[model samples]
Target chain A: MPSDSTIQVRQVDRYRWLVPKQGPMRVDGLVFADRRLMADVRGDQALQQVVNVATLPGIVGHSIAMPDIHWGYGFPIGGVAAFDPDEGGVVSPGGVGYDINCGVRLLRSDLVVGDIRPKLRELMNQIMRDVPAGVGVGQRDLRLGPQDLLGVLEKGARWAVEHGFGVPADLDRIESGGALSGADTAAVSPRALERGRKQLGTVGSGNHFVEVGYVDEVYDEHAAHVMGLDLDTVTVFIHSGSRGLGHQVCTDFIDVMLRATAKYGIDLPDKQLACAPLDSDEGKLYLGAMNAAANFAFANRQVMMHGVREAIERVLGRSWTKLGLDLVYDVAHNNAKWEEHQVDGRRRKLCVHRKGATRAFPPGNAELPAAYAEIGQPVLIPGDMGRYSFVLAGTERASQETFASTCHGAGRQMSRTQAKKSVRRDGRDLRREFEEMGIEVRAASFATVAEEIPEAYKDVADVVDVVHQAGIGRKVVRLRPLGVLKG
Target chain B: MEDPLGPGVREVEHTADVGIVVEASDFEQLLHRAAVGVFALMYGKADADLGPTDLFNPLGTRVHLGASDDQGNQAGMPRPITVVGSDPAAILLKWLRELLFLHETEGLAYRRATFDVVDEERVSATVWMGPEPTPAACEFKGVTYHDLDVTPGVDGWRARVILDV
Candidate 1:
């Protein structure tokens, strides 16, 4: 039910939409989209998903949708909803999504952009070989036992660092020191555990990729300098997530949420938004499993980052340590956390749900690592293989309105089916076109290649511009792709 | 229907092999003739002689045939379910998704399936679920419509799909 249809929307800015609460909705809904981005959502169900999320119990402020809004299983891909535990808020698998903690990480190096321009082929080849690509890809030489896998899940990048994947201090640049607390290996399912055993370092198929980029522009000189990046420095961005283990954790919880939705007397518009009170058993269980998977994703990226470092070392015949290959930052797009945000003139812990959106905490927030306290959290945004990626910093306005969340990536403008059909009709040979564009492409199947065609997505620059202009996230450095390896 | 694929379907990129796509003049032929393709994909075998069981809809939308058997694997006695749908897209998607779902949830995997279809929009075909695939059987990750089409061609109706390895 639309809850009496009294929920009103008022344009707060060119890029933001407000949903005012009237009926059963506890809080209003906020959507970030400019006139250009808003056009894509006109006939889409994602907007309806935003409205549907407003009816959940204990929702705080407004149900927020980021700029890259697309219809997903439950919440819109670029959606953020905060639930208050004091009022019996809930956690839903639809909120966290199948690929739990499916996130992106950025790696910066001291190498100038011009240094590796000629050797792009060799670099892509070496990275592809070092970091195995495609479905169920694993390092045959590095299988782990149950204890080892659990340790990886619990320790995140620390596990990779312990195994000589990278130096010890790389942890300072990662989110949650590369491992979010409260990850219990025992809460993880055996199938999830087994599937993740060999997938620690592999970049799984579909939308996942490893891209080598060059700093194209510097928007914030001080922030870039603090982050050890200069205009024209080479960087590597790893975009992947917790793989199969995360998928199962979500599947396991959807069953619980489905029943919880009905038992708790919550009337919902979509089954995908099935949720239970945050204090309930199902909620706790899903949170535990989701955090475990999120930790797995963190560890997964750490392992891949280590692999990238190794490949760079092998290609250049020098130690990555000697090259100052420091990690920039990593952030998860799909997650719900207990965070203290002021609502109704009081501060309370709300379960913030950022599905396909990243938290954009402003500067001086205690969560920031000691180094980034002055500049705020490092926000990494990756675009299509054919376009440019961005590095942004959080702003105070993000705290006031959005509870510190921003768009995830270039939103999909077309369905997968439409993408495949369109790319094929354009007479564009994806592999050849990618090669001509100086990008190496690999996939388990040809269909995934077509679905991932660049034309299928909106220009990420447009999406990032809305956030940057909106003062939610500010651009720091822009990075353009030199080569990309897709799943 | 005429396709340029080879006669035998064994393996592709990695493990988890053995499946085929069939063509037809219309929806009827698409479902009716797909059984032949299913048998061909499953090492040219079938459950044609198996008795009728039941037709059920798990998702409450599509047609599904759930047939089971209490057979003793090396471990002990276990049961398996086979589901079939009329729409080739629906059937193939359901078959693959169900197989993966069972593996993830119920710890069950299917090595082979005997699929039969009915052409009508409301009528899905039949499926005889078989034992979980052994280590030797290839697992198909997913089916994709990269260059997929079901339009009438020079010969009949055809489609192209890439199976995720």
Candidate 2:
């Protein structure tokens, strides 16, 4: 196994390192990290995956990695790569990950920290009951028939809004207006459809959660204000994805892409990177299916948000609307989208894949909603439940360097087995530990909490600092979790 | 029945997700042990126990066994489980994916599995769908081909797999 000392890296700047393009690589690899984080990154196989990605046909700029980069299947988590369709660039299922459009949503409320402190336990219990969580646990009330499921695939979050889960205005605050265009229901498989039928409005286990927090500090006052964030104001964060539907979609497409890879004669360094040309029949089908899955994910989070609103209202004895519980913004961390970026001084159309990275579009980008045109896109980075999360704003430097991408989260620092072993060896009571910190945590099982211990992840503040220093994203506000509900 | 391969599995360290290493005296035993390892990882050893069952009615009358022609409706059926692949590696991948799908969609936890036919190209197994178990510690999204290997070693047949959680 290659170690930190074995990997070759040339320092590009204080925050950027270049893995010089060599061997079969078509482009250089760029990783953004400071000295301390770079040491951790080099200790894993993530940089090697970056090099493998560079070997893919039609790669643009550099195979990029955010500071939070870690070992993943084909592309490292926190890896971003763009491909030119006209140049035989392809889309790989591994690049988008299994949980299609797995993303985060933030909801800001009028209530201050003082108002929710005393009722935090009640509110957490309310959310735990209202939201179906854990593996295979679905909302019995939200089950969809075949036809209704098709509507979700086609309309994404709009389906939830039309179903009266939320108002149509919520759609505008979401990326791609809560639905990706060109989603073809017919392209989705029966298994995928079946898996999605009863799984809507669920938070599946492992790192996914519904967190209640407060804005503890504001780094960029103007941007924070634009995002409806105020110091000491309570907020809600939903972290989940399309559930079984998306996993089935990715599984189905991997078989398709494997065949496509052979037909296109594309040699692969890793089978997980199986792909086909973007314009090929196989590629187009995968894209359509993937988009449909992405839509389902959008609707899943939207529905869950509705449930959260209901829970909050029931607990507070006030209507959600009356409390000003409105969505601030929603962004997908796992997806591939057709975007235009400047390359070699020429504007080119490319398909950008962000596996475990978030889109950080600069202010003035036409894609920004009118309200955020001056403040840039709102980026929510949720840290471990015990510590604090951050809100960031997209920067012009990100657009110029990394196809407008930034780190997703703190990223896992320890394996699940390692975490469990540590907990058992030390005989630590994870729940009591969190309670000691004054954070209430309700989970399906204590084992889940042990695996998700704050020690298992890097300090998100450090991750955020690297991106902020690299100028990919600018820090806006810091959020401290008061209560958390996990599956 | 005398065992041809010793039964044992261990969790391997993976940076992001869960990884397991399974070993047996032959390929068939390796597959069985891998399934055991997966269930153990999801729910722990106490809940991973398997009950004895007849092959013809492995899941009993509780599960409906019928073939669905429509692709979307396939996950609705719980039996007559037949999986085909081009090679041993593909077969392993398909088998693991099927187990994950069943666990995620049907709420079926397998306590025992009996393979009627096992080869490089096809596998037919009757998995006894036991009572729904407690919530798993973690949810495995899917199996990946990343660094997946199934080969014969000096001890027996060995396989390594990574599960996306």
Candidate 3:
């Protein structure tokens, strides 16, 4: 057979390319990136993955990549696709990623930017110190027993809220109400259970972070107002996910599916996309385990919010309730879910795979919370600690088109190693750089600090603009970083 | 003899979808071979033989990747793989993982790879998606890198890659 090198590349526009369908590919691969980004992206193997995903069984629409697309296992990061279960479509871990429901949440404060700038360092510092970080550093040394853990897997942040991690209103702003049902702890391994026992309230390392910021700019006045954003308003952002426990769950099942492939007799272009029929016992087991981890992530973030509230109270010497540290919204980035969408003009249920992407359900969708349904789902996109983040609302355009998914954040512009090397050469102290930017910074490790320097990522503003212009999601508020806690 | 360090990528089959491990002297080389191996199973070829004139030899591998199960809802379990290797290291690991995944999912198999060095983190290879290597068995769902250990060798370069499967 002709080698993969025989694969052809066709530029479709200034920011998109086509990996033509040849060989076993079922559809063409589409990449979204400016010429500048594409040059670097093309040099990576992610394009091949995009092409490879097209060959999967029953993948509908385009196997698409966001501008932040980067090389990843099985499926490329920032990739999206939909599959039909009736057609033998398969869900691949490589498609959703390891951080089950790892995502971003934006909190809008009633306070203005100027009011907090002078106290930015203290605010950021308090949040950073209070939130548990690093790998497996438990919250107040809290541990979950089987019963408590199972309850959490089912109720998610609701459990945390009931226990005082947050209030009832917080659920109104959460995607899937902070709990994705169908979490079967039985699918989980003891190892995964052990690792997650104390980690539910902690932030895991690599790309996970919490930041404090102020609204810098607003593009769509109506949309921004609908999103509860005003110029210079203070906001807080949390980006993290299910930690080691989730990783173990995935590890627990990769083996199970390997056998399923043989039973189902499906052909695979990439092994990382291992799977069984959706109705198989193996599939059900994996789904249960994955959901449990997802619930864990939601609960973890909720407790961290509580810790942030406590820290705020400690620093400001006032109650968070009085200060008004309320959640604006939370959205998962890398995940897979069952949803109803228009397929060939019919409301068909399908498995939507959004890896490094967020669901931007348009306004009027019944799924959104009462308050936000009028504005649509809140899409929280976080930028690098040194850059700015944005709040957006889903659009009908997105729902009718790309399965209500949009790009997650500023895609990587430079490799972490390359960023490190360049910083080393330029004598840039990652810790000091954020300080100079007037953004408080804390980290679990200096290496990670150095590796995630703001320069390492593409200008997130550009990424948010793409989706906004494309009408997938409309801009709401602009969050400029004040401080960051990294892991 | 059984490979004590779990199964090396070499043990990965096209259709078994089994996860395998790959090691290299350095991060860059490890990623290089891993990428090679992932793609190797898809196009079906031994990427080792296609270096020099083929693969683009970029300088690095930097990206965050996650894998998930196919079931919708909470069933969509994702696993992350963090690797950095040059052509040889990346190609092998990449090919093997891809083969292992295919084996677990589709029950396909192919023996070799043809690698084209695109850069340090990127490689292009053709894999021969052969017929099923094993019949009436399980499929590999995904691969994950957790508490992954990659230590530099005495040669001052080393890597440890673990697949969740």
C-alpha TM-scores of all predictions:
0.79, 0.94, 0.76
- Every candidate's DockQ is 0.05, 0.29, 0.03
Q: In candidate 1, what are the lDDT values of residues A65-146, reduced to their tens digit?
A: 8888876646778999899989988888878777788899998888987788877777777787777655434555566788
Please list all clashing residue pairs in model 1, or write none if there are none. Answer: A28-A62, B16-B138, B16-B139, B17-B138, B111-B133, B117-B125
Alpha carbon lDDT of each predicted model: 0.69, 0.85, 0.66
Model 2 chain A: which ten-residue window has the lowest total lDDT? A1-10
Model 3, stretches more than 4 Å misplaced? A1-6, A9-18, B1-165
Interface RMSD for candidates 1 onward, in order? 17.1, 9.7, 16.4
Query: Model 2: per-residue lDDT, tens digit, A170-273?
Result: 99899999999989788889899878888888888899999999999999888888888989989999999988899999999999999999999999999999
* Model 1 docking category: incorrect
TM-score of candidate 2 to 2 decimals: 0.94
Q: lDDT by residue for model 3 over A1-487, one digit each (tens)?
A: 0123446878876656777787788877877666776665666666777888888888877788877776666777789988888877777766777678888887776778777778766666666557765432455446688888877878889989988788999988888889988888778877667556666666666678888788888876776765667787777788878776676676557657756877889786665677776667887778778888888888888988888778777877878778778888888987788998897778877888888889999889998887777788888888887888878889998787678888898877665546545766776555556667887776654545655678788888887777776567788878888878776
Ten consecutive residues with minimal summed lDDT in candidate 1 chain A?
A: A1-10
